[model samples]
Target: MSFRAGFEETWRAVLTSRTLVSTMLLAVVLYAFYYPAPYAHETAQRVPVLVVDQEDSGLTREVLRDLAATRGVRIVDTVADMPSATARMRAGEADGIILLSRGVTRSLLTGAPGGGVGVWVKAAYLLRASAIGEGVSAALAGAAEHRLGSAARAFGLRTPVRVIQEPLFNTSAGYKDYVFPAVASVILQQTLLFGVATFFAGRREQGAPPMRRAAFFGAWAAMTLLGVFAGFFYFGFIFWLQDVPRGGNVPALLLTVPLFAAAVAALGLFLGGLFDRSERAMAVLVPTSVPLFFLTGSAWPLDQMPAWLAALAHLVPSTLAVHIFVPLNQMGARLSDVAGMTMLLAGEVLLYGALAGWLLTRRSDTNPR
Candidate 1:
């Protein structure tokens, strides 16, 4: 088949096959809503916390008031002792506990080393626990500062330095903003990968002849186009609707999309050539999604991964694409900033496209259409 004929045939096959349509198109839409549903609130808010105020002093009360007013925490109830606070946490009544020890007020006022505030968080959910810890810590810090400031003023002295914190990129530091952008790239790769693999594998199962160079390129192009569409759907609409942090360099992001899609499509075509049946493609590829996501270094840093594993991760298109897209779309990085990685992605397109073409060409020789 010629390039145009192969392109048209692949498009027709994709549109006609219920399996392909569901895997490629429907799955993208479904995941766009489903994957991010839990993170809809963006950041944890008003996380219930129990306060164990062993010292019911005026200072402790002021700290509790500030803690209750914080966006991340709410003082659901004040308990008499540590045992009661622990019981409430175990019963799921609160996400965290704050203990103002008997001499905490004295410690703060005198700068003594004896008694201090203690925080206990149910670490079952790290993000919730972090929010609770941060909120409680902030309140305690404010109280401590106020006590110290009063003493400083009495002595006619001033604090030499004050630290101001400003979060970068994901300013809210919400789980959705931190995670969804990277996962979106994985979704784009996996969907297109599964779709293309299933499509070509099904053809092989039906005893279809192997595609020539032009035909292979044509089919690859078709899949690449679909992948690009799915990517933009996430980058353009879903981010906006979900209110995930965005506003990166749009033109740079646009330029990166096709390179990412083409590389994934080529990888899919190559993997599809190995499968004799569509079922085999799904069986092998489905389980790989989670592992591939980890390899992207979004949830975990590549530097911390074993050196070999980190190096190997670069072979996956989504890894490179995540690095490229996250910086461009989320961090507003310039094209030149991501130029090296973009070039690497283009290299993947060449490497995988060559392998896929060679494999298909060999198959054509044996099948002898």
Candidate 2:
């Protein structure tokens, strides 16, 4: 049979198998439907706080009022000392502890630049600790500035120069924006990895020939591209057609979107060749997908992860693609800066496609039954 005939045969075989058809359609929906991100509440919420009012004065009461009122923070009560606070944290009642030094009030009233204060957080809840410290410091800074008053002017404490910190890529920091596009590739990669297994299994069981592999691959790519565009357009339009302030660059996204689909399809091809049984491939893929998503820096910053794991994590295409698409959408970076990202994505498709193709070429020798 010619390559064209073989491809038609494989495709027909694939379509005739309800499992493949259903899984393919399901893959499209999973890729297209709502992209979920790490919940905000997961990062910080009802953070238990223990305030040590060393001053124990009216001024400290005002400070307590301010900290308690802050969102996502709950001032449980004051501990007798740092030791007590530490014990509570160990007991799971508190997330952080703040120690107000004896001179906290005096330092503000005296118009001093520095105040004596100590803040400690449970080792496990360091993030919540840092946030509590920042909130308390901000409140104190405002109070100290007010007390400095006219003296603050003489000392140039209230300098006109304001250092404004702006987050570029993750402005709204919506779970949808920060996580969706990156994770989309992860889901894509794994599904295709397992999906091609299903595709090839049915073909092999029916004694299909390799002559149509190209046609099957071509059709598969064409269909997959349609799904890719569908996902991008659906989500991109959700922001643009709805006039949301999502801050995505439409043109850049157009260029970057195709790489992910291509790479994912190539992954599917690689997986199809390696597995004799669809069920076995599906089993391996399930365990692999979780770590793959975790490696994309969704839960923790990649920099903070262990050095060895971080080095290995970069090998995944989803890692590179996620890092690229997010910045393109959020930063609207010019072509020159993003050229490297583009290269990484394109490279993945080329390398992985070649690998999968090579594997598939050897399929007949492997004895499918």
Candidate 3:
């Protein structure tokens, strides 16, 4: 068939195929709203904490007041002992407990490292624990600085230099902003892969004739277009809806999208050739989501992964896609900043596309029906 005719045929097939329609269109629309709902607030706020103040001094009161003033924490109760605070935590009334020892004020007055502030957090959810730890640390740091600055003034000495932190890229440092961009790259690859695999698997099971070179290219082109359409929805609509960071250079995104889509489409076709039935493709590919996502270095650094595993991960286009897309999409990176990953994705497009074509040709030769 001519490329035009084959392209028209493939579009008809995609329209009629339930798997392709659902994965390529329905899933993207539904998840665009659903996935980001949990992180709408960005970070948990005003976590309840109990304070055990054994010092019972003016200085301790001042410190406790400062702790309560922090936006991330709420001092729910001031208890005399650890047992009371433990009971509150057990009762679900508090997320953490802070114990200020008796010698705290005296030690500070003497300019010695005073009795420490003990922070106990519920580790069941690490995010909550982190917020609690950070809030407590900030409060204690403020108190220490106040005391030390006063001592320095009395001694006619200058205050020590303190570091000022300004978080860039992710100004709020929210989990949703940090994670969604990476997952978006994975979603683009997986959905396109699953849809193409299902379509090809069904075709093979029905004993479809081997495709001519033009026809194969036509089908690959149609799938790549669908993948690119999905990418538009992700960056244009979904990212805007969820308020995920987006300052991607238009040319950079336009440059990368087709290469990423084409590579995924070729990979899908290559995998699809191995399946005997429609369902088998899903069975083999669906479980790969978790492993592939982690392998992309979203959950862990590539440098930290075992050498063999890291090398194997780099072979998949999505690994490089995540690295490239996240920076461009979330961090507002230029094309030059991501030149290396762009080259890798372009290479995968060539390699996977050739491999897919070779597999189809080999299959036709073996059967020759």
Candidate 4:
């Protein structure tokens, strides 16, 4: 078959197959709304916290007032001792407990060594824990500065150094904004791989002949085109709808998408050649999704992973694509900034394309037409 004919045939097969349509096209649209639904609130707000005021001093009272005023935490209850605060937390009445130790006011005023503030948070929900920590820190800082200022005035002392924090890229520092952009690349790869693998594996199961070189190339092109469209749908429209952080270099994104798509499509075709049944493709590949997502290092640092495992992860298209797309789409990175990864992505296209072509063109007794 000619390249154009193979391309048209693949497109027809995709459109006509309900399974392929659902997996490739509709799933992308469905997940765009579904995955980000829980994150609609973005940042955690007014996390409930119980305060243990052992100091019971004027300084500790001022800090409690400031903590109650902050948007990130709410002082749901105050207890005279740590045991009561711990009980409230264990009972789920509050997300965390802040303990103001005895002599805290004296420590702040005299620069003494004994008193301190202790924060105990439920690690069950990391975002809530983080919110509570931030809220408490802000409140304590305000209280310390106020108390110290009065002391400084009496002694005619100089102002203490203050630390200013500004969040980069994700200004709000919300969970969704941090996670969704990285996951978008994984979604694009998995959905496209499912559709492409199912299509070829089904053909193999039907005892179809090995594709001619032109036809294999054409089929690969068709799948790549679908992947490109899916990438744009997530990066362009879905991001805007969900209000995830974006506005990266448009030209760099344009350059990166096709390379990433072609690599994934080629890799899918190569894997598809191994599966004689369509169901086998889904059975094997579905289990791999979570592992592949973690390999992207959005949730965990790659440096922390075993060196060999981290190196092996680069063989997957989504790993490199995540590194490229997240920065290009959200961090405003220039092409030069991601040039090394871009070149590696292009290399995967060549490596996988060659493997796929060789695999799909090899005739076998089971696939004989």
Candidate 5:
């Protein structure tokens, strides 16, 4: 069998449509702000910080109170020592740490030097660490001034508590490494979904039948098999060759990419069949993305979103696929953890495929819109 001329023509027709080009332009404009960009909001809120009260002094307690009552800082939990704090931060538990040593208050009161407090943080997060340090230092400075006379507190202020931030996984504070891979997942879902949706919808409108539709779909699967792997392998090879982290298990992720794409393909076919008119379908499809990405934990953390909305997030295939691929691509999560996400894609494929087929039986040329 050779490449179908009709298939090429169908693709050319869809791709060349002036309306589709206009939609693409519109998409780019919308995504300018929708996609990750510069952070203008400097006032940080809910900044996670851990505390180690080794001193167990009144001064330490007062500092904790101020930290809790402060606007920018958020006290997540208390730890025992540097080792404990290091472990928690390593597991993505806390962003910064504050360790108060013994005699810190005594030094401030008597003007006698003592072992100082240590603030440990990931050096990669320099800006955030600095913000945390400033907040903590100001709070502690105020407390010290109240606890001791101005002269005695002045000595302690000159020799302030140390802040140590160790950048563990990513040492360079690269925003690209953190954000691009996740955005890539969004790209994968949108582009391929559009391709898949257009694939079947265009053919069905042209009067393709059981065998022809089957053949075209089979060819599409083959095409997606190549494209999905190409996208995954291309990124993986770049990471290996260019020193970007091959954050996920390369082979495992590569294996899953096609399945994820296939599920998305099925979803598009489902939508395509649901709306026979190409223009109408594209119109409905294009607008749906903004709300979908908003709900998919791309802009907001899943934990921060409302309970119902978070559950609604799981309804879309992109939600699970994004959860599995983005984190794996960025942070190198194991496949065992994302098995549920894969299953979520499978379930949606079944559901939407059934709905698309059912809707077709009821569709008619004169059917009311």
Candidate 6:
């Protein structure tokens, strides 16, 4: 077969194959809508907290008002004691409990250790817990600063240094914004791999077709094009729709995207060639998603992982691709900044493309059954 003929055949197969059309293309669209739904709000808001004010002092009241004012938390109920607040949290009416002891204002007034504020947050959901805790702490800090206003200034009791915070990226500090870019990279690799695997595994099970140079390279070209299409659809349109932070380094992305897609497609073809049946590819590859995700060093830092494992992870394209894509796509890194990973991705394209082609062209008896 000529390259043109092979390309046409592969294109037709992609159009006809449910695995490529529905599972890969349509699924990417569905995932775009569904995956980011939970993150639509960006951050949790107005988390309910039960306030217990035994002191009934002006300071405690001020703290309550501040808590209510913050968008991150709301003063859902004012209770008289810890037990009642605890019960409210347990009943799911409140997400946290804040307690002001009886002598809190008296102690502050007398310059003696007298009373304190206690905060109990539901730690099961870390993000919610953090937002609630930070909100309450800010309210308390502001109230304390206000109460000590003139007296502390008169006594020259102010700290010499003031810390001002300005977050450079992920400015809203939303969990979705922080996590989705990394997850999207993994999704691209896995969906492309699975779709291609299913297609080739089906071919292998029916009986190994005569390996022609054109057909083999044409399949590779077709899968790479499909993979690139999937990458752009997710990285371009989906990320825009979700309002995820993205950089416009088109040149850097253009270089990285094709390399990553080609490498993933090559790897899928190699793996698909190893499988004797269609179901076997999914059974083997689906379980690898989680392990590969962690290996990308998004969930856990690569330096912190075992040295051997970290070294091994570099062999997987995503381990390197995430580093390249995340910086180029989300962090707005320049092409020069992503040069190393760009080289790595290019290397994967060459290495895997050669391996896949070699495996496909070899005698069927040599391939695993």
Q: Which candidate has the top score in TM-score?
A: 4
> Cα lDDT for residue 280, model 2?
70
State candidate 4's TM-score: 0.94
lDDT of 1 by residue, 1-369 (tens): 788998998999999989999999999999999999998877788999998988899889989988988999988999988998899899989988989898988888876777788888877878888888888778888887787788788899995355678878888777988999999999999999999888778877887787777888899999999998999899999999988878668888777899999999998888888899999999999999999999999879999999999999999999999999998888888999999999999999999999988877676756643
lDDT of all predictions:
0.89, 0.65, 0.84, 0.89, 0.65, 0.82
User: For residues 1-369, could you state the per-residue lDDT of candidate 5 as single tens digits?
Assistant: 223643454455545765543432344334434443453233355678899888898888988998888766789899888788889999998888888888888776766887577888778876678768867887787787666555546675544454567655554445544554556556556765665565556656777542333333554455355347545653565445434445666766775787676666667767776566665666677677677777778679888988998998887776777788765665667888788887777787677655654544343334411
Q: Tell me how far the alpha carbon of residue 259 in candidate 5 is from the true structure, in angstroms, after superposition.
A: 1.6
TM-score of each: 0.93, 0.77, 0.90, 0.94, 0.55, 0.88
**Which of 2 and 3 is the better model by TM-score?**
3
Off by over 4 Å in 2: 1-43, 106-115, 122-127, 150-164, 173-177, 205-207, 211-213, 230-245, 294-315, 361-369
| Reference-based TM-score, model 5 | 0.55
Query: For every candidate structure, what is the RMSD over all alpha carbons to the true structure, in angstroms?
Result: 2.0, 4.6, 2.6, 2.1, 12.4, 3.3
Residue 21 displacement in candidate 6 (angstroms): 1.1
lDDT of 3 by residue, 1-369 (tens): 656776788789989877788987898787777777787777767889999999887778888888788877899989979998999899999999999897887786675676767889898977777788888778767877788888888999998567678878877788888888888888889888998888888888998867777778888999898889999789878888788888867788898988899999999988887788989998999999889999999899999999999999988888999988888888888899989989988989899899887766555544442
**On residues 175-214, what C-alpha lDDT tens digit does candidate 4 reach at each position?**
8899899889999999999989988999889978988788
Candidate 4 weakest lDDT stretch, 10 residues: 360-369
Decreasing TM-score order of the candidates: 4, 1, 3, 6, 2, 5
Candidate 5 lDDT score relative to the true structure:
0.65
Q: State candidate 1's TM-score.
A: 0.93
Q: Note the clash tally of each candidate.
A: 0, 2, 0, 0, 5, 0
Candidate 3, residue 162: the lDDT equals: 75
Of 3 and 6, which scores higher on lDDT? 3
What range of 10 consecutive residues in model 5 has the weakest lDDT sum? 360-369
